[model samples]
Target: MKRLVALLFALALAGATQAQDGPAAEAEAAARMLEEATRALDDASAARDRVKALTQTVRAYEAGLQAMREGLRRAAVRQQALERDLAAREEEIAQLLGVLQSMSHTPAPVTMLHPTGPVGAARSGMILADVTPGLNARVVKLRAKLDDLVVLRALQDSAANRLEDGLRGAQAARAALSQAIADRTDLPRRFTEDPVKTALLIASTESLDGFASGLSQIAADPTGAPGPAAELAKGSLPLPVQGRLLRGAGEADAAGIKRPGILVAAPPRALVTAPAAATLRYRGPLLDYGDVAILEPRSGLLIVLAGMETTFGETGEVLPAGSPVGLMGGLEPDDDGIVPARLQDPGSDWTQTLYIEVRQDNTPVDPAQWFRTDKDD
Candidate 1:
């Protein structure tokens, strides 16, 4: 790679020695631009690796934190439920005790010893209506309390377990986040050119056409580090994210447009992973496709995952299968709180849909053939 860069540098110097005011000068500038672009690709690849590693770490940490948050939410709900149960039980117990005390109170003196008198008979009838039912009510309330107590104890145990899991998850997340930050901060770059050239290259960062043009000029195998031959694993690749498939490749949509990729139904903030070990071609906002990610699992094969609200990492990074790429977007499962409404595409109903497209030789192909189909099946 260094040799290639040196050769480009030599070309630039040669053009300068033969400096002319016509086509020759234009050729020199073109050569320099090509050289700069090539060098930028190399540097980007290295920097992106750092970004990918860090992104994976950060995503992992997020997963852990999410778990912890969910745990706390569940625990709190259970705690509230337990409190309600206790309060209800206390009220019922107090009512039952009152009935029992009333029944035990000595009968009025007029009816105490007048066994066959009118007052005594009337009092006996009152005992059947009031005292007998109170005794039965006590039995029922006692049994209900027993059942409730069992449930309350079980809930307590579950809450304790979830809280423990949350604590461990929190610890793991912190460690991963710290490590990711350190790795990203320590990464070095390959391009050490003059600040002006560096600035020019940076301007082309998000310009796909310019960047692609630069990649076109570079010879394959120039660095002797050939990329993965991902074609060999075709028809057996895994889906990047875990979820149900909403649309298959080449399927027509409601808008009467044929889809090039498959759409998968995923929750907001769900984990997105690489289907295979490969380099990330690009990760950024693309035309009308919110937060897209392009990965090269193998030479000549491009895998695109798009329609995310947020994504991690950058362009030019390579990672193993199952490595974190980014997260999907949707309203949280347990959240129904009020939020400011925003105008969205009528065709795009839920924000949780992720589009997947696999291109071989830059042509769209059926992704179902490469990935695990019938995901739910």
Candidate 2:
């Protein structure tokens, strides 16, 4: 009776041990699946293909977790199988022990009951123990690998966001540069035509050149003509010298205030000659000056004669200095409804002087600087 009781107790202990091992083996298998999934995710991220890889990795990790859960479920279900296997093993061990005892007691023949049987069964148990520990270790390693994959995905997302921001900033900078270029081109034309603006610009140029030189330079014509002191001085080059200096180049006061181009103060119907040998660039009506003629001299300087009675020159027509460009006319009323006798120097309230402006490279520079004259009065 004591021996039977011991056998039953051993069988129960074996069943319990098998049941514990079953779940451990399932967990190890599940961990291995998770490890594989994480590895695939890592490869996709390393390729730098897209965030789609991250999504796939996440799915694979979820699948691994699901597989792990399934493994645990299977382990629970296999508990019965573990119990049956253990029962059989325990019965075999007990039978061998019984036979050994019996053989020891037997007098005549020593019959070894199932010799080598117990050795095989013990070996199987040892193998199972070894495999279970190894599987458990693999499960630990797989979990750590999965964690690293998650971190990599996060970093990729951050990098992509920054790249997008930098691209947007570059686009905005290009737009600003284009706008600045356009503004610069329009500025010269807009400011040059305004009478008030023109006066201010001319005055600024003169001030930059100093007073005595400025006045004499505008009063004299560049043409080497023996005449009045003012005519001898190097003023704006007179392409057509027939017209007298109606008004000098500096400040003027006529109707309200006025400044004119070397206002020739010619006869009402007198022919206006080119101040210098020049090509007729443009001949048409201007906003303030009714009839205008713009002549380009060989020296690349432009002579604009405004407030004319008629323009005899046409565009692209070449005329020598002192050639007839147009005829003089009385002042035509402007937007202010005042047909002022001359242009005005807004800075000094001086009037009746000609408004002669010079430009280089389409940019207005100090005209007085180019004019020649003695410094001493």
Specify the highest-lDDT model's number: 1
- TM for every model, in the order presented, reads 0.48, 0.28
Worst 10 residues of 1 by lDDT: 337-346
Please give the distance, in angstroms, between residue 280's alpha carbon in candidate 2 and its true position after superposition: 1.0
Clashes of each: 1, 28
Tens digits of per-residue lDDT for model 2, 188-279: 11011234433444455533223212222232223322221122224545423222344444546576454323444432333355555555
lDDT for each residue of candidate 1 in 1-377, tens digit (9 for 90 to 100): 22323332343223212222322233234333333433433343356464454444434433443333333334334445646776877876576555545544545554345567878777876775675555555455444444444443443343444334433443343344334534553322211224343345446556433433333232233343446544555567776765668888777888977777788876456667888877766666665678877777767777888887766554445556766677677644232111112211212223477888877765678888788867531
Whose TM-score is greatest here? 1
Model 1: CA > 4 A from native: 1-221, 229-235, 330-351
Q: Local distance difference test, per candidate?
A: 0.53, 0.40
> How does residue 70 of candidate 1 score in lDDT?
37
Candidate 2 is scored at a TM of: 0.28
lDDT over C-alpha atoms for residue 222 of model 2 = 35
